[model samples]
Target: MTTQLFVPKFRVDECLAQVKECLEKGWTGMGFKTVEIEDRWKEYTGLPHAHFLSSATAGLHLAFEVLKRKHGWQDGDEVISTSLTFVSTNHAIKYAGLTPVFADVDKYLCLDPEAILDKITTRTRAVVFVGLGGNTGQLDKVAQICKEKGIALVLDAAHMAGTRYRGKHIGYNADVTVFSFQAVKNMPTADSGMICFKEQSDDELARKLTWLGINKDTYARTAAQGAYKWKYDVEDLGFKYHGNSIMAGLALVSLKYLDNDNSYRRQISKWYRDELNGVEGIEIVPVAEGCESSTHLLQLRLERRDGLLVFLNEKGVYPGVHYTDNSEYEMYKDCGQCKNSVKASNEIISLPMHVGLSKNEVDKVSCLVKEFLKG
Candidate 1:
């Protein structure tokens, strides 16, 4: 049997129980459950404002758009970003008509703060920091740099649902933070995300902008005045990015177990660390000092990444690569250099990590890795 890189295990009974409520009530779009989940997220993260969205991608795009419009940022303004992240992170920058300037990654596969400081220019408006694989890395340093430079910070926390730094949630200091509850993320929903903004006004503005720029969403209008529910105003052009009640329902169910689930993922990482630490020709990625990571992935840096990938596949222990350098993409070919990111992009591989992943399987994979590297 193949030991897959990721296989999300959902609590089916719990998920159905929540979805059944939405079906019986017949208000399955953008209201009841979404509102509930938004509240739950705020309570869980202790953030000031949380808005549910169709996906993390939408949340990230809206973050850039709102910040750009609010600050009157012109097109071509730069947002420093890690090249070693999902394309969605950078795509959001382009969607807002801003440029993405590539930044090198640190040992934790996160944006290097020194690299960020080096890249700042007159046009640099914000920095998009990705807590890759749920590890906070040097995000605190990055946050401080942004604060001192008077630049905005947008955290692409797709892999950081339960991740915490210094006993507080990861988003408290960020200008905007987006979290994914996609099919394969630590928090599994069909697909959805939460956007938490530091400012209440920005959160309110985001609510309108997500639903085609309407002043009052259908749920809000219905609750206020029955007949006037259909009446609303459009303030600005927006996308259909609001999440539905069904995804929200699933998310609520998943949220109930996120902590325990993340705890198991950390245990699996511990096993990987015990088995592979200090092995020659390989380097296990390090989590940040203060991060209680959700352990979304167990990644390693190997000199022969492609060869080991093929070797693992032959053994029915398939792994994955977190990302390719975004600068290598045709759309971003001219983005500035990211030497560390380029090195990491070529050398990194994500090991099997999920609730279903077994310790025995982790040991087997590590043994094979040791065997291959020794050869």
Candidate 2:
């Protein structure tokens, strides 16, 4: 069998170095490196505060819990969100006891801003915008509408680690932005996440909430000089959502090369635009103006998607699909608002995208895709 091109680039040695540090320190639960990662994240995004969590799903859940409590949200209060996202995104909203108001997407396959107006009602307490396909499409408009209507903006930025809007990071604008560092993301730390909050009490609250509602974290107690006493207060509700040191070490190393890695992925995306734009029955996604995507996904709308996928696989080019619609899932009932998302979901195909593929491999994949259409 011929070697297949893997979309994402990964290095065992890079991950191993961080793991080695954790082994040597022996305090590999959630202290030194986790704090370092949070500090570096603060430096990178310039957001007021950042907390490392177990996963982006955890981050999203924490964001919703914090916002819902702050806004006095009742059970089943509505939150406008996209159906064209990972199930975890919607699941987090549900975890907060809020109803998800499914919305349509625009050309960029992101949540439609205008559709948000129709979905909003008196009970609508927040807007959870997923940065679909790695692009922050019409995010500014969504934020503006949320602010004007006095609803919170909770960003499910799982795909937007390196994305920027008008020279500012997307995480900075939203009330709370959740980032994933899962194995396949732009910055993978096996499985870890970050919640970048806009301001103070929310940040402090999140920290406590993740660590079993304790007033002080393990780091504070461990790092103290005197007779290191364990004393704390139980405030709001909390959970065991805190991340450990080993993942944090991995994250710190991953951060160093994330930007450079994303740059290569972006270049591959541009190559797709240049090469496949001319192919018949192929519609490439449009990039929103003034926004820079992390290019986590390179999705295409094609006429013969199922057949094309089979053909690509036959030729040793294994493409993928980002998602199936959330409404299709039995647990989540259909809200029936997102025709565009459902349509795109049916036709969308995610081509190989990552730093792993070289220029020659990219050229070969593109050529094979073109050949599939001819045959």
Candidate 3:
């Protein structure tokens, strides 16, 4: 059997049942299930407020938009971000009409706090930190620094659905946090995400902003008994980025299995570490202290990453790269100067990680990697 990167496993019967509930009620857009998922997410993560969105990208864009509006930030204000992330992270910054100041990453492949300080300037408004592959490298320090510097912190926790820090779920400290429930994430939901805000006001504003700036959502309007059902006012310019009932239904089922699934992923990571540790040419990316990662990806740093990727493919095992440095892209070239990000981009490979892989399969992949290194 070929081992591939990121195969999402779903509970078909349960998922179908959730979908059936939505269908039977004749409510498949934006309301019923979406509300339930938001409430459940808050309870699960202990976040003050949660808003369901079409995707993490939308949530990220919304986060900045809400923050910018609330703080009265001017256009072209800067947001410090790591270059070692999906372009969505930086793209959202641009979508908010802000400048992205590329920063370096730490050993765990997360934004480096010290580098963040170096990037700070008078116009710097916020720091966007991505918890790459669920690792929370120096996030506590980063959060503290942001607070001390009087800047907002937005956590792009796209890969950290089940990650925890100091026994609490990640994102408790950030001004806002966005989590991806995209098909291949730890909590697969076709394509959806949750934006958690530390303040209830921001959550309320986000809810309004996601539904075309309507003061009252359709669900609430329909549930009301008066002539005011259709009397909502468009308070601000908003995007149609709210999540639908169908995706919310899928998210509910996946949330039930997320903890168990992540535990197994962690085990798979351990197996890889045990097999590859002390190998002369390989370096396992370490999870941050006090962080119980979701193990979204078991990444490794090695000199022969490209050659090993091809070798693994020939052996019916396919690995993948998490990202290329965002600064390397033409759109971001002017801001690209993070040496560590460029170096790590060349050396890192995200090995196959999913709920379906068995211990034997992990061993097989590891042995193949060792064989390539030996050659």
lDDT of 3 by residue, 84-166 (tens): 98999999999999999998998998889899999999999999999999999999999999999999999999999989998
* Candidate 1 structure lDDT: 0.93
Candidate 2 lDDT tens digits, 172-218: 76999999999888888789999988978899889999998988888
Error of 3 at 303 (Å): 1.0
lDDT (tens digit, per residue) of candidate 1 on 278-302: 9989999999998999999999998
Error of 3 at 25 (Å): 0.8
lDDT scores of the candidates, listed in order:
0.93, 0.86, 0.94
Error in Å for residue 95 of model 3: 0.3
Best-fitting candidate, measured by lDDT?
A: 3
Report the Cα lDDT for residue 207, model 3: 92
| Worst ten in a row by lDDT for model 1 | 220-229
Candidate 3 Cα outliers beyond 4 Å, as residue runs:
none
